[model samples]
Target chain A: MINQIRADMYRLTHSWGFYITLGLVVAYSFLITKSKSVGGIMVNGNQDALTRLSRENWTALDGIRGTTMSSSVLMYVLIGLFVIIIGYEFSQQTYKNTLISGISRFQFITAKYVMLLISILITIAAYFATVIAVSLILGRHVGTSWAHLMSTTGITTIAVAFFISIVFSIAILTLIVTNSVVISSILIVIFPLAVATIHIFADWNWLKYIDFFGVSNDVSLGKLTISQFGPYLLTCAIILVVCIGVSLLTIREKEL
Target chain B: MTETILDFNNVSKKFGRFQALDSVSFEIKRGDVYGLIGENGAGKTTIMKLITKLSPLRHGSISLFGETTGHYQQALKRTGAMIESPAAFGNLTVDQNLKVIAKQNGIQSKNAIDDAISFVGLEKKRKTKAKHLSLGQRQRLGLAFAILPHPDFLILDEPINGLDPSGIIEIRKLLYKLNHERQTTILISSHILSELYQVSTKFGFIHHGKFIKQLTKAELDKEKQSGIRLEVNDVAKAAEVLDNAKIKPFSVSNNHSIFVQTNQLDTGKLSQLLIMNGVELNGMTKQEGSLEQYYTTLLKQTDEGEK
Candidate 1:
């Protein structure tokens, strides 16, 4: 398993798609910070139409955490990463080479999951660093202390990392089952919307507990208490386990 | 007393309502180039998949290197395969593609990769991407990947699929070299039976997922009809001399050859008789049956038995 993971890392580093997607994630962070500083998104030629906060009152930590919180937008980047990491193998049928090289289905899928986790960590770090660099260069006020900013941004990074993991786990499971990147990407994009749509139609308070995307929105990392964060973590854990489990099972039965 | 490299015992497979492999069983021993002969959709690839565990085995047992108990990971470590089409990352260069496999196999030596590339005659194309390669080059790339690990056993399905005549001969020699030098046991399937005949030491005939026959090259040679073929100076005179010698069922195939379908023919007696009768005998030898004819005849018998 370790060797498989090592080989995958070598492939990942060599892949143009990985570097391109990482660059996109960083570029997106810069764009988001720049746009947020310019008052907000333009709506019908009005620059302040969606302006809810003033940049003068925001801190560098806020800039970084704010970009991380928009994991909804970041999910698409994760999809691209997943496509490169997992989808390409299935499409090219190259996974058979790995398996026939003595790697088991369990090790193969586990290695891919680990690689996804690594990519999420790297993307999170890059996104955070980009937001910070852009904020400093754009002359945003340091409204918070460095210690406070680091702690809060650290917490938000973890939360966002957890969120991306849950999202890409679904992508991994779907990719393994269907062996189609397009289909897996569709499901990845549609899953949050589907969950949100279901909650809207049912109007059930209990749905919020399962609506990870909705709950993720309310996660103001530094402000949340233990009781509030525990359930989210638990839900993320359950979903990750289920996705990993199902992926392993289905891959074994898949006629490669 | 040779070691068994692979064994399929009463293995069967079904895809929904379609039966792909039906209680099929065969064995490949050490140093044996086992040719798996079957028509299209005759479960050749299915059997390859089963042996490699690409498709899960539901009915019977498959022992690789005498380990049938577990997932065969340890046993598979010493095995290499290129089943179906040659699969590779189109974006990666041939060297990089092979490097990925080398990494997976924990082979830290770059020499192994170079050796495989040169062995498959892809030394000049090592830097070319697999997608940019010709079909024959891709086939060679697949072979290079399979042999990279220096495996004790190899399972190749149509490994010569896209090769030209010379390329086919090169791969054939490569297989022979692998068997002779490395003692690599092989289970190969190809539509080209004559090529298979040139290399394989043993053979398994399959039809409709059933193992119809399993025989060695020598057994196959004996099973096939053999007859004496004589290249004479005068075909008509040879026919007359053979006729006077009470040699029934002799034929003048062309202007200079007479085919005698008799295993009991006295060559010395015939040569003397033909010489005395003014028929110059150039050469005389026994001709073995062709793989195509034997395969066709076997399929016919199998179909008749089914009916």
Candidate 2:
């Protein structure tokens, strides 16, 4: 399993898709940070107004909001990672090269899952670091101390990671079952928005658990009380476990 | 007796409504180049897939190196395969593509990778992406990938499908080297029967997902009938003359040649008879049967028996 992971890491890092996706992540990070800090700072007719806009300060709250908002968008953007890492193997038939080498199906899937989580975390970290740096440079008054900023951002980031991890696991399962990148991509893009839209008209508490973007809103705002948070996480955990189980079963005896 | 490198016992596979393989059983022994022969969709690729576990082996049993437990990952570790077409990451360079394979197999020696690259004559294209390679080069790359692990057993399906004439000879020589020097047992299948005939020590003929026959090369040679071959100026005239004389079971093989399958064939008398009949026999020699004839005859017998 470790050997599989090591080989996968080499393949991932060498892939052009990895670099292109990472570049997009960095570019998106800059855009999100700039917008969150320089809201309505577009040049007006007056020179004085433009000068004053440049002097305005950004707060730690601005950085946290930018990072959390980007995380929600990042979930959609990172769909390509799964396509490259897992779907490409099936489409290109490259997985046969590894599987025929005496590696078990369980180890192959488990190694890929591990790589997916690690790559996602790396991109999330990059987004977080970029947002903080950009905000610090723009902010004249961050806070009396950096403690509150660090702790809040840290907690929010963890929540967002947990949310995104569950969502990505669902995407992996979809890719595995369908084995078509186009179908997986289309379904992944539609699933969240569809759930969120349905939850609005239906107005069911249970419906909110799977409405990924809606859950992200609550998570970003730190609005979940212990009572609400427990069930929400429990539901997501169940979905995650089911996805993993189904993913394994789908490929267990597949001809390819 | 030689050790068995691979054994298949009553293996069967079905894809939905179609049965791909039905209780096919065969074995490849150590130091043997076992050529798998069949028409298209005759369970050749299916058998390779089952051996490599590309397709699930649900109905029967397959054992490698005497191990039959749980898909035999440990036993498979000593084997290598390139099935159907070569599977490669088109975006990766030849070296990088092989590095992924090497890493997965836990081969730490850089020399092994270099040697495989040179062995397949792809050293010049090591830095080129797989997509940029010609079909022949890609085929060689697949062969290199299979042999890189220095496997105890190798499974190749149509390894010469894309090669030029010279390329075919090179691969044949490489197979001979692997079998002679390394004693690597091989299970290979190809549509080109003559090429297969040159390399294989043993043969297995499959038809309609069943093993029709299995024999060694010497046994096949003995099984093929010997006859008189005449190259004539006019094949039709020679055939007419032979028919008039009631020559038993002679076939005009081509535009200029006729073959007579007779145990009592007298080359001198046959040549003189053709010339005297004004058929103009240009040459006469004894001929052994070809792989094409053997396979065709076998298929005809099998089909007739089924009826």
Candidate 3:
């Protein structure tokens, strides 16, 4: 299992697309920190407001929200990276080579999940590094107490982790079902939009509970109460398990 | 008794109501270069896929290296296959692709990858990406992947699909060497019967998802031997003349023709003897059955039977 993960890491890291996406994420995060844009939309079109936003006390919680909000639009970059990484196996028929090399289908799926975990960790580390560098260069001090810092950073980390897990699971499920990079990518984009639209326009009050984007929005902004957080994480976990379960079942029975 | 490397018993597969393989069964023993011959959509790839567990065994069982395919990871650990076209990451170099497979198989030695690349004569092009490779080079890379692990059994589907004559010879020699030196049991499928004829020790003919026939090299050679074909005026008289001359033709047809299954017979003497006996010889030709002819005849027979 470790060997399989190592092999996937070798392939994933060697890809130029991986580096391109990482560069885009870092560059986009840097721009957002400098400009103080929220959700990629500039506020008030006022230069002073941007300056005040950048000059505010940069607590770890603020850093998390800023990084998450700035990087949200670039989620498509993550989707494309995985499309190349996972979808290429089916398109190129290299999955058969792996299976024929004696790796079980379960091992194959686990390796992919591990690869995604490592990628997420790396991205999170880079995001925090950029946040720290920008905050220090701007001469902002950490004003929050240790207890406050711990609670805020912990909650923020859990929220981001859950959000990433949901996205990663969806990306995997899409790739497994479509097995084509183009179609999977299209579905990845269309799925979120469709879900968000239904949740917004539908008259049913229950639609809001199942809205993935709305839950992610609450988590990223640190607006969710403890009660809401538990259910949100539970929903994300259920979706992750279902996606993996369906993928394993489909792959086990799928013809090469 | 020789050990069986691969065994398929009553394997059947279907894709959306179209039967890809129907109760197909065969066994490949150790050191046997089993050639699976068939046309397009004849379930050759399907069988290979089933052995490697690329496709699930829906109706029956497949055993590899004496273990049921239900434990595919264990069964396939000692097996290698290159099904359909060569599968590789186009972005990775040939060397990188080989190393990736080696690492996946948990090989600690780098020499294994190097040896396989050199064996396939890809040393110079090892740094080249798979997408940059020609069709023959890609096929060789696929072969390198299969043999890099030093598997006990190898299954190849259309390994020589697109290759120049020299490329074909190179791959054939490489496979033969692997078999001779390592006693690697191979189940290879190909449409080129002549090329397969040169390497395969055992042959299985599949048509319309069925195993039409399976034979050893000796059996196929016997069917492919050259014979004397004589068309004379009188069937009984020609048989008598040949019998009197001690030729004892292999078979006589209703159209006054005799088939003597021997290339060593003195045709000149037989013709003189026939004319001397007043047997009017209209035509005589030496016919040798080829693998292609045999395969075509087998498919034709199967088609006629279906009709």
Candidate that beats the other on DockQ, 1 or 2, i.e. the better one: 2
- In terms of lDDT, the poorest run of 10 residues in model 1 chain B is B236-245
Chain A vs. native, model 1, TM-score: 0.87
- Total clashing pairs for each candidate: 0, 0, 0
Worst 10 residues of 3 chain A by lDDT: A41-50
Q: Model 2 lDDT vs. the true structure?
A: 0.80
- Order by DockQ, highest first: 3, 2, 1
Docking class of 2: medium
| Tens-digit lDDT string for candidate 3 (B14-72) | 99999999999999899999999998999998888888888888899888888886785
Give the Å error, residue B63, model 3: 1.6
> Against the true structure, what is each candidate's TM-score?
0.87, 0.88, 0.89
Residues B200-292, candidate 2: write the lDDT tens digits. Answer: 999999999889999999999988767888899998888889889999788888999888886587778888898898987778878778887
Query: Cα deviation of A45 in candidate 1 (Å)?
Result: 23
lDDT of 1 by residue, A10-52 (tens): 8888888888888998988888787764321111112231243
The CAPRI quality class of candidate 1 comes to medium
Residue-pair clash count for candidate 3: 0
Model 1 misplacement above 4 A: A37-57, A210-221, B228-288
Tens digit of per-residue lDDT, candidate 3, span A160-197: 54566467777787778777677767765666556656
